[model samples]
Target: MTFACGKRLFALIMSPFYFFQSRRRRLKRQKWRKRLRRALFPFLLSLPPTVWGNVNDFALIEGVRIQPPAAAVLSPGTSQPNHPSPIHPLPPLELTAGRVLLQRYGCTTCHQFGKSTPAPTPGPALDAIAHKVSPTWLAAWLEDPFTYLPASRMPRVVLTPTERREIAAFLLGLSPGWRLPSRPDLPPDPYRGSDLFDALRCQQCHRVGGEGGLRGPALDRLGTKTSRRWLYAFLKAPHIAQPGTPSHSFHLVDQDALDLCEFLVRRAPSGAELPDDFTFSEQDTILAHRGLRIAIERGCFQCHAVRSLRGPSLPMPAAASTADSWLDHHRATGETILQFHFLPTARLAMHRALQDTTSIPNPVALPSDFWKLPIPPQGSTPEAYSPENRDLAPEACASCHVRQWEEWRNSRHARSLSPGLLGQLVDEENPGFIQHCLTCHAPLSEQYRTVTDGDFTPDHGITCAGCHVRAHRYFGPAKPDRRLTASRFTGGQHGDAVRTPAFRQSEFCAPCHQSDLAGLAFDGKLLQNTHGEWAASPHSAREETCQSCHMPDGQHFMTGIHDQVTVSRALDLEIDWKLSPETRHLRATVRIHNRGAGHHVPTYVTPAIFVKVALGDERGGVIDGTLQTRIVQRRIQLFENRELFDTRIPAGGAWLFEFASQLPAHAQLLTVVVEVDPDHFYRSFFEQYPSDSVQSASLIQQAHAQILDSPYILFVRTITLE
Candidate 1:
């Protein structure tokens, strides 16, 4: 064979091998690109759409974008589709179904919601019901609201036929002299009204025939519930017809309002008739008086506003009923329109209401026999000593423990039965209610008037005997020195003290400072959860207890949210600012850290911490529209029985409040103020009890004034700028 022929054969075989190697390399490059694209896909999507102009035109796979021609390009400053602003993210406002129920049922009248004051009473004022609706409609509604409007928040109220008639008569008789004016000009136009309803988007907030938003009441039975004239008046000017109504006036022409009213009223189910004209008569006077009695008995005034009826004065006939009985009645009979039986916590709240007791549960766990007075020491006569000595009053204890008594005297515990509490209990005739309050406020048996026959003085609030004295023996924490024994103490007249290590544990304080009832919790958090909060914190692992901080060094002064020094110590605040010369704007950031405390800075719902920032002129006055405020606290809607927001900083957690605004031409300084309100909830609660509405008006007024005086500035800082 020739040399040239052999060379040509080898070259052909090598050419095929080289082609396979090139193909493998190309395939490897494609795999790498695919992996890289996958890694960048999420990061690209997270970027603003403007980052990749006309994002919709491109199909993004992994990190690569494949776009077709004709895709629009978005340039800087060009208008874009409306999207949520991303400058700063805010916590979402949480509203629960439970809260809606509470508001609908008029529970907010007595209970508050969030940091704001309690909202106006939910139920309509009954003073003008006679002039507003037909007597037949009123009776039917009072008897069974669900039958008329299936989505009604008004509870069934368990009224009998006679009771319903009487209640209707009483309400109708409220405005006996006034009558609804006839409006003959407005005529029926159901078809036009239906069109107007759709144009107005009425279903956005209201429901008709069980389809629409739940913001407003269902209009399914409006025809049977209200007259044509009344409905037209309401549609024309909702605010004027029913002040504070959530319904808004559409500024419609008279004819349009008439049409809309007709359309809404026509939504009634088949066979339903329109409400007829109503006239009040002298015979209603007798029925009204009886109705008033039943209304008071049934706690109707608790939620509904009636000008003729004052706050409930008569004691509840079932005041002696136990919590279980109250719960059972609500569960079995369905007296509550909301059907509280399904919610154990709600049922418990109803029980508390029936008992006229505060929603706060007993804090401390006491023995069954804890309230019983101890038997006098052997041979000690019942009348041998003064009442103070016999009862082991605080004054007697102060004689021996001067420092501790002095500290405690200035503490909140000493004023547990302050004017606020006393005012509520002053007109309260239910002994059970009073007793439940005294269980924590004035725990000693001797302090209870019912038990001691007025022997106890109200001034001696939480007496020393309440915590230390039991069975005529002194009880307290064990001595720090393990070597010391009870035998070492000399028994003079008072006898040797009984010591236990349990007093040093946090559990000892759990009874009063913690609520163990799951039903009482909102958002899975107890109303008073200091102990639980501490348990979840790192301090608990380090063996820190409530006494370690609140009662440091065995001090009787239990300093808490009210003490400026203590609160300041628990929190760490920092303020930083940066001035942008380009935009002539100043950005300031204020950070608050719950650094020292084992739990939340303000551990209970009662206290609120506010951080306020604003621009100030040379005179130190805040500039208009330049102020910003942030609150750090657990905000609850008492009536709604739900937590609206919990901005409270947990242990070791930090909350940031950022402010960015253009520097005003005359701005000279930046000021920040931090204020603490120890009685925020109490202030709102006290303000709700109007002088004319409640029996203990004077006391409530005094309480309101006292609570108003409780807020104090915690921190203030000012920075100067040229």
Candidate 2:
């Protein structure tokens, strides 16, 4: 028994060694067979008549003998035959070639078809896109690529139709069959549907849900709220109808109209919805004082009339609504009716109405005791207030120009009459001068002619009839129909009724702006001659209108030459610095030159210029600093917004300065910064409208330095600092 057990143990111990030996022998035999086959196969294939081949044509080296090809080898199609089938299939070759083409074209640079590695995504991925796109789509896309994406960065690939088909087949094979979500296919006829919607008077304030007016919900995303069939049946027409009320009204239409119902369906998450009925309120009403001011300040009258307090009453509402269509229709038709009638007070009244309803809170408050404030009355109301009969008070016609009224509510002009800027210029010690400047600056209607200590209001700035007066004879841009007509009213406020295109003419502005500099009774004394200065300029001599450069496209978005865009282009301040031991100072020399503008070097459009200097430690904390400036146009009134000044910088001009500061004791690095004013000196302050002519003048300008081996060594940087 002991001998048998020992035998079993011995066998178990040798089994592993035998297994390893067997594997090694098998590997060795495979390697030998491979080598032997390579060596003998060619010789065996060529063994047709090697022994008898011509001995003179063969050569012998050492113990190996060789024979010429003609004597030893078999010819093609003779002994060894060619195979009938190809070694590899064609599909794999085509796929490999297509992939190579994709790489060569750089398609993978921005797009990742199905990459395993993560990379920054430059555009949307096309993973499994084959399931979504049809084969025909791929062909058409390759043919005319631009039709798919107007802003495509993809360059056109010159692939043959066959290659495109192969690629398309490969992509389509990714998913055996993919189906579109179950939704009824709808025709794309949005324009026709829009016309039908309008014809049906559906837009009479009712929105479809999401595709409709802002006043109501546009119904395009209605699937979450209602079912498709319900919508379809509703369109077919509901039996019960409500009058005046929206739900009671019939919303159903014919089969063709029901086609739009498909667009109403959509996918949604749990409990998704639009604003409920409880959210609608007067707050939604937009009272744009900007629009109103454009009408009044630009002189909407002379060619147009409204329901006036004086003269013939024209058609206009007592108050204005914020509805877009209402304003549009009024503007479109108002001019036609104004030519034959006069409406003056309507504009003023409308202005009052807008002030009460607008939501954008006014920062400046109107005085509660306006009647008690010391106010100066006008010499005479413009003739628009004069009635054919003398017994009635002259009615201000501004009461009817609702659009202009709303705009004035938000304008700085509305606050002009407040006892603020111009009023402060009035020497409280001398009330006579206050009354004197009041005539042109804050002219009241003939009906409200009186000077007192208790009747002040915001009606002091440039008012109606100031621009609409007869001499200006203003007309807005010509309508599509170019027929000209004369106003029917007799001459009074709006100058003599005349058939002229004065609105389009520049001379209309000369009256107020070009007023005689020396004798003008404005600002309690002659104010600086701005209009006179402009008139004397070459720009005026060349017949350039103020609106040409100041108001591009006649927009009120006032901008100035010193704005960031203009400044960046005009002045490039290349700053250089060096540390001088003798002076113990870090000196910075700024080389500023105007590059692409036509104005002066430093024209004064606004009042101030500031230069700031700072000495800082390498850690970026300031050690010492100070600022300097020249206030060119100082405020004449105490109440001016942000210290009013009129400063302008000429085009194509440069202003340069040098700053020096002591270096910190342990400074390792230094930084320099030169930035322009944040207010855009000229733009944000003075003009009612300014253009974006300056761009480089951002609020912050900075530069940095690193300490090298030597403290004095430096690198000069040339960039737009401010």
Candidate 3:
């Protein structure tokens, strides 16, 4: 046959196959389009009418309208302008929503957005991807994370089928020679796993079938997406799979892990299978290389750690740049809106995710003149009274309540404006930032330097007046008799005390202790979750509160982890020792229980407890190398916005530390020391503030030194076994 005829014959033969591929691609696109519309329709409908006005003037993508730069995005409590101007319009909802979306998705991790330093990327490190998940699951996850986990913060990057397979190959190929452990022959008991789950209090952080906490991913259909083998491995040691995962290591036995895997896997719908069309070959170096390039080009490295590629840090957004400018820049480059085919869906998803995760309420509005105390009520202020009585000061209150003042003086509330905080504020030019810190540190309006009130005492830090006096009237918890009245003599001095039950409620303290900043959260948990922690505990149901223990007997001492006695009372330690005389070996098992604390023991990330076991000589010291230590704390890398691990014992939970070692000669004693560092995280944070880097260097140095001295031995027990 002629060459031309051969070419024609080949083309005819491949036409049907090409047509089938084209049809499949078109159907896939249609499916996603419908899904996006379904997800976004209700969100768009709920927006204010103003947002939909002049829809023809805005960009239309897949039947949804994107608001123009002139359109205003009104949050709750925001009102529309009475008379809108054509030349200078209100800032678009797009800009506001866009900035929020950027932060929520961790865009600032690689790209500069504003004056604030970029937070660490919140993505889990992928070093052990091979062991954590099957290649099929990884490909499906990379293709569209929302399919498997709707609440995931990861944005779907548009990629072809080949690209998806390549990316999966690249990630799975990270540890080329890695292999999964052999599965046990015996079947696991799901019933036992269910009991173990409850015992571990997994519901405290994770959800199942839409009925648990939002701190971790929902496990409703986990079995369908992952294999029992992978689940068992993950349950055994979550950190080994994903180093920065917020999931705690429960140190489960092999049988327990197997049973938990069985229980979780049983949750999948009966006939469901792992989602993927093609198998990925980790040995395909060419495909992996291509995938790495695609990952880098698509900015996957920005949020995720791609071992083969290192993304460069972009320049910070200009100091003068506003949110509007930032959005405009991204829009101009088509990076934020046009690059992603489902931008509308992503935006709507972001709104939903935030609503689900954010636990804190909106900021309460204060009176316009809230900074100044109201004019002393009609006849309450007497000219016969001295300045001490009229002035809004802790010392004035101390004149009558001497004992409470003495306790408050030595409390953390008194030292709220610690050198560490003050040092950082010294160089902070933003008034909003300063106010945010002082909101909890020195809560009184008069304590603000800008208040211009004569009673401004910034150094007093959470004075008695801050909590008890407002609008020149005294307020406190209702007396046991429920009487709102004060004595006839004292009533004239500070006005009739306004007795309210709110003063005794946990919600009263939530404002400062619980935070909901989307940018600061890890695994959907707030940075400071003490109030949230208490709310989830049995204490909240029983009406026990932060004040119950911290301020026992209405004492002003606000005792916390810093108080050695308080900490010792919260934790119960038990140690078991086994010595092998023939082998000259010692094995120690120590367990620490959070029995008293209403919240997690060492609740916040600031404190860490070290459980150490070491072999000691007759002199009580000279053993060379037989020490083992386990830390109990929430370890987080703040700058990277990643949580390495959370070993903090939850209320009523316990942690086990096992140590085994061959004893050296002359090791006559075994010592176990449990040390508590109240300022563990702060020590590292403050150490970064060098003299040349900040204006308050001396203060920072002093703060570091103080933290170094804050650690104290919580428990020490020596077992002599010569």
In order, candidate lDDTs are: 0.59, 0.34, 0.60
For residue 31, what is the lDDT in candidate 3?
53
Query: Poorest 10 consecutive residues of model 3 by lDDT?
Result: 1-10
Error of 3 at 342 (Å): 75
Cα deviation of 341 in candidate 1 (Å)? 68
For residues 1-722, write the lDDT of model 1, one tens digit per residue.
Answer: 11111112222222322233244465564454345434444443454333333212343242245542442232112344323222221111111222222323333333332233322343577776765677778876776766776546566676887787777777767862344445558566989989888888889987876699988877777767677776777776676566667557458777787778778777768976434434457865767776765775554654576654432222332264653553454245332222233355444433343333211111123332332222112223222122333556677665435567778888888888776777655644334335445656676545655333534454567768777766554456665442123122111123233455556777666545554332145667656667778888988889988888888888988988998898888888899998887877999999998888988878888889989999999999999999999998898865455799999989889989999999988898999899999998787566653222253677678778877767899889999975
lDDT of 2 by residue, 452-506 (tens): 4434443435544433332222223333233222211121122221223334334
* Model 2 ranges with Cα > 4 A deviation: 1-409, 421-432, 444-453, 470-527, 532-544, 549-551, 556-606, 615-620, 625-648, 661-722
TM-score of each: 0.46, 0.34, 0.46
With a 3 Å backbone cut-off (N, CA, C), the pairs that clash in candidate 3 are 120-639, 120-640
Question: How close to the true structure is residue 218 of candidate 1, measured as C-alpha lDDT?
Answer: 71
Score candidate 1 by lDDT: 0.59
Looking at model 2, how many pairs of residues clash? 79
lDDT of 2 at 584: 58
Window of ten residues with lowest summed lDDT in model 1 = 87-96
Using TM-score as the yardstick, the better of models 1 and 2 is 1
How do the residues 1-722 of candidate 3 rate in per-residue lDDT, one tens digit apiece?
A: 01111112222332332223244465564454346445543444344444332122332334445543454322111244323212222122323333334433334333542233333444666666666676667767877776776556666677998898887777767772345677777678999999999999999888887688988878877765676776776786675544555557568878888988899888886665556456655456778776665775565644555342323333333233332343344344331232222255345433332222211111122222222221122224323223554576677666446568778988889888677777765654434334445655676544656432223343477777767765444556665543422111111123234455566777566545654322135566655677768877888888998888888777899999999999998898898998898998888889998888888887888799998888898999948778888899898754345689999988878999988888887888988899999988777566644332344787788788877778899999899985
Error of 2 at 613 (Å): 3.6
